[model samples]
Target chain A: MATEITVGVGLIAIGASLAVGLTAVGTGMAEQAIGAAAVGAMAEKEELFGKGLIMTVIPESLVIFGLVVAILILNLVG
Target chain B: MLRPKQMLKLTIFGPKSYMKQVIEELYDMNAVHIEDYTKKSDDDVFDIGNPLSDNEKHSDTLVKIRSLISNLDIERKNILPRETSFETIEENVTKLHSKVSEVMAKKEYFTRIKEIYTKKEIKKALSSLRLRFDDEFDYTSAVYFIGFVNAEIAKLKEDVEKASKKNMTFDSHYNGVKAIAVFTDHKSKDDVEKVLEDYDFSPIDNPVVKEHFRDLTSAPGQRFVKLDHEVKAVSDKLKRVNDELSELKGENMIFLLSSEKKLTMEVEKGEAPLKFATTKNTFLLRGWVPRNKSKMLKKKVEDVSNSKVKMKFEVPGKHEEVPIEFDHPKMVEPFEAFMELYTLPSYKEIDPTFFMFLTFPIFFGFMLGDVGYGLVTLGLFLFLKMKMPGMKNFLNAFIIASISTIIFGMVFGEYFGFEFFPPAYGEHLVDSLPEHLINALHMHPMESHGALVYPFPHLFSRSHQISDLLSISVLFGIVHILIGLVVGFINIFENHGIVHALEEKGGWIMIMPLIVWLLLEPLGVITGHVYDMLASILPPLPVLGIMFAVGAILTIIGEGVVGVIEVMFLALMSNILSYARLMAVGLASLSLAAVVNDLSGQMIQSMGIIGIIPAAIIMILGHGINIALGILSPFLHSLRLHYVEFFGKFYGGGGKKYKSFGYSPK
Candidate 1:
């Protein structure tokens, strides 16, 4: 029974890690294109810096969602 | 405070003769945003007006003064702006122009002479050939080729002797590359030349040599000495000319800058009529003025034109695109820089500057919550404010953000990631507080050895209270998004009536309660009693389901199936969840500070007296890096939250910023 509980805890930790890690990778993928385009746009019109920043970080919400899900998984299950 | 300043369309017409006067008055008032008149191809009634008389003269003077300023490298910052009358400017500008032109001409001449004589390659060639300027060549009997060659002198002589049947005379000298002079009879000149070509010989131009030293009858060394002396004299003259130009710059820089400014204004006023539509004898000018300032503008124009000009003001039409001028109080003014950095609110849309002013700093402070870090950043921003006055607005926003950091730091009871104070302080002052106050603060006293020590009465310990902080962050997100939706509703209602506003923004607002209920229900299970009370007071789950269904239907009606999906799944869910950054970022900062403190503490304890150096170094460098990231990360995250989430809801920015005529940017 103790071994079963330890295995369960390890699985929960894996689940939590996957939740954050995969989403972070996804966020990075999304931000790669957006950040490149934003930098290109900012190069032409410097006033677009704020808009470029907003555009570049819009995908950051994906990572935040992942983090929240991880926290919830830890709090509710672990 | 929420709306831009109201603008009225203004149209003024006058006799062509009074155009200059009216323009002058308008410029002095600095109230109008002139709309350039584009001629319609179909209309033959009026055409773009010609510039006023003397426009050419003013333009010419302005151009000349600007060139003079650039030529002298007289920076505007170096000279104080002073008032100079037009007559004085006119007289002095011509005089300075002539003086500057004369000096420039002399400098150019000396520079050319210096360039010509600085070619030391010719002197090297002459020295290699062992020749003097006075050395005469018998060009009539023998042809000579004197320059550089890429062959051995002995081989060349043998080859040339064989080619010309021993009829040629050769003299040679070698540096890195060989220089030779070959003298041959006319008959064998072709044969010698052919042989010389095989050896890759290049002949120097003789005319340059003759022209440079035409009057000299001395040897090459004596001639070069004379040339050096002449070059020095020319350089001295060039230096003197430069000194004169600098002195002239010192004397006239202020006058020239003042004149340039005055003439530019004159030229602008003179050319103002070019933007007007005109008939044979009358001109028409159309523009916009602030509603409150319309009367003043009209009066000023009339006074200048002696009532000859006719002015009309009218309220703008619904479809008209008006320029936006933010009307915010002084304290809220700095937040407009954020709007400018993004895009200004359209004239009809609500200005979110005031809202950002309230929320942006709170978000920033929440993420960078530490008393020591806050104080450091606040001092840095305040110091920057004094040093860079041009960026006052941007820095002032950070100042407010850092102040908020301090407030949040107090609530978190964190002093550089420590509880109330660093561990070096031994015991916190909270431990000495009276029992009543400690109880009121909900802090428990613990037995430490024999004495009772009360923890700091912080509302939240960020490092330990992760669950609580996460919940609170989500709660703040919900409230902030709700505010954004309400503002969106108002914005839509103002522009597109109530029904559409309800269908769009109201649907989201209706769904918010359900979202809140769902989020809180989980918390209720964890916290127990508060959730029970909330559950009792709140609508049942089935009712909330009904509300969600209704809200979803409204969203679908407003924005179709895609809109329902976007508003529900993306905007409402992801946007709110994005505020988790507030917790995550602050937690990250706290964790880093804790690590630094731990590492330094361990170093100090383990290494004894010598540990002090590395520990101090680590403490300074680590905290320095943390503080820098603390300022940038929080500031950017807060801005991103507002710009991407909050402003995305209601702001339909792309407003034309109101820039009035004759107003020069400093």
Candidate 2:
């Protein structure tokens, strides 16, 4: 019997790729909306602009979530 | 804890009162009113019109005149005909004005006539007259000298005019009114009158008259007249004051106010509360004053209320001290603290914070179910919570989700989007694995040609199969509804009683699981070749009917027939569909990652190693972008499902938070 490659690598790779891809997409969309709102808010209230900008970037954690998955994929494949 | 308690109790007195004082100081102090101070009577007050800086000199002059008049004290004594009849004063003033006007007209005519005529002819005529009086005396100071000189000159002019008028044949009665020019030695009233009369020239010619004329023209004399005029003006004003004081007479002497009637009225009534009944012997009054003023105000209230009525002060908590108050009140502190882990947004009914915590990890783990991803997320949230104070909230929230993801990843049998668990810890955890299980569930992340799985797996390993998708969906559905039911029970029980919870939410709970289980079980009496596989699992016909009967009764008892119908229709549909999103998001993340890998893989192959580097970079970047999108999709969408689909079954919002005005930013 010709032994197949371990499906473990494939599952993890797919999972990680999904994790990274979905996270990046979700956060990017969220950031676009939130960033626009923050910029608008900043224009209105300059003092609160810094804080708003920071908070707008807060949802970017989704990207971090994706990056982690990508790193996991790299480690697993490597 | 110390800060939390302080947040709970608002300070009764402090900076707020000081702030009030600062405000008081900034604006006009006299403008604001204070209670308990009696306003003085304005009856005796003299209201000077708005005094400008220029009024300083005028005021000084007024003061000097006032002193001169007061020194005489005639007006104060009320001896100066106390009532100077306006009519008599008017008549005397009119007559005096006419006399002055007549004298002024005569002087103007003589002066102008002199300017018109020859100076030499006028001098010759004056000298001829002066030679008649005295060549030794100055012509300018002659007793009626100007009049005498003008008379001689006038006589000459009249003879000429008489000649001219006689020659022209006009009326001869135009010698102008016989007005005598006054030249007095004294400044006395009689001296001026005598000089004006045709008789009594002795008084006008007296040595005193000459001295008086000299005195009238002197600087001190002019100053004296000004002084007298000022004195008279001051005396007249003082008399007006006396008149006003008398006219201000009244029966009841209440304090007069210059401010608005309401505020001044409030001040006068001892700052009484709006609801106070003055008719009653004692009254109850309550109002908020600044914290700094609390002590002083309490003392004032005690003094006014005579210590009979009590005073209370309430100060609300500050944001930093009890930021949770910015959230909710009735929530138990620990729950509030837990909720605070997720922001307790003031506006939302459901604390989506908890929902975020519960759902984010599930979504994140499902999308990025690698042990490595979970660990990374966990570490990131933890570090953020520790290091960045501002991000501490987000960090804590994410950390909680990451932990959930880590746990869920283990259960899902996924590690880094892959199925590496069995190989990694095969002997220790799962003794065996299976054929259909690995292939269907495993997520391939490697770029290698192909991968296979070890055979013979346990039931848990088989839990994620495609056939079991419905069952998994049903299982999740039960959990979701149960959570909603639990929350409903908690909510109703908190507000109403347990009886309400049972009446409303209890029935659905009992009916849901029973219905699912009954449907899943086979219940067939047909004994045919095609039904052989399902027939073994079917309950006996008699028992099946009885089971149905019990379930029907329970469904009716737990939820009314209508409720049962609604729940069966709505809850089952919504709950099942809600789970669909989970699968959808999971698939979406997986598919996107797969596409990125495939695209980049093609690039790498076509371009060679150098080309592969760029392809690999693109893959990394593209996959990175997708991971971000994936993380949020599961997280927020899961929350949406929970908040809208689940929690709607059980939440009521609209509790008015307590707001105290004693301490505020103003």
The candidate maximizing DockQ is: 1
lDDT digits (tens) for residues B415-445 of candidate 1: 8876634332424555566878766654665
What docking tier does model 1 reach? acceptable
- What TM-score describes the B chain of model 2? 0.40
Point out the worst 10-residue segment of candidate 1 chain B by lDDT: B523-532
Candidate 1 positional error at B620, Å: 2.5
User: After superposing the true interface residues, what Cα RMSD does each candidate give?
Assistant: 5.7, 13.7
Candidate 2 local lDDT, B312-385, one digit each (tens): 55564222222223332332222333333223333223343344445545655654443445676687667767
The true-versus-predicted C-alpha distance at residue B336 of model 2, in Å, is 6.9
Clashing pairs in 1: none
Error of 1 at A14 (Å): 2.8
Chain B TM-score, all predictions listed: 0.77, 0.40
Global CA lDDT computed for model 2:
0.43
Query: In model 1, how large is the Cα lDDT of residue B128?
Result: 46
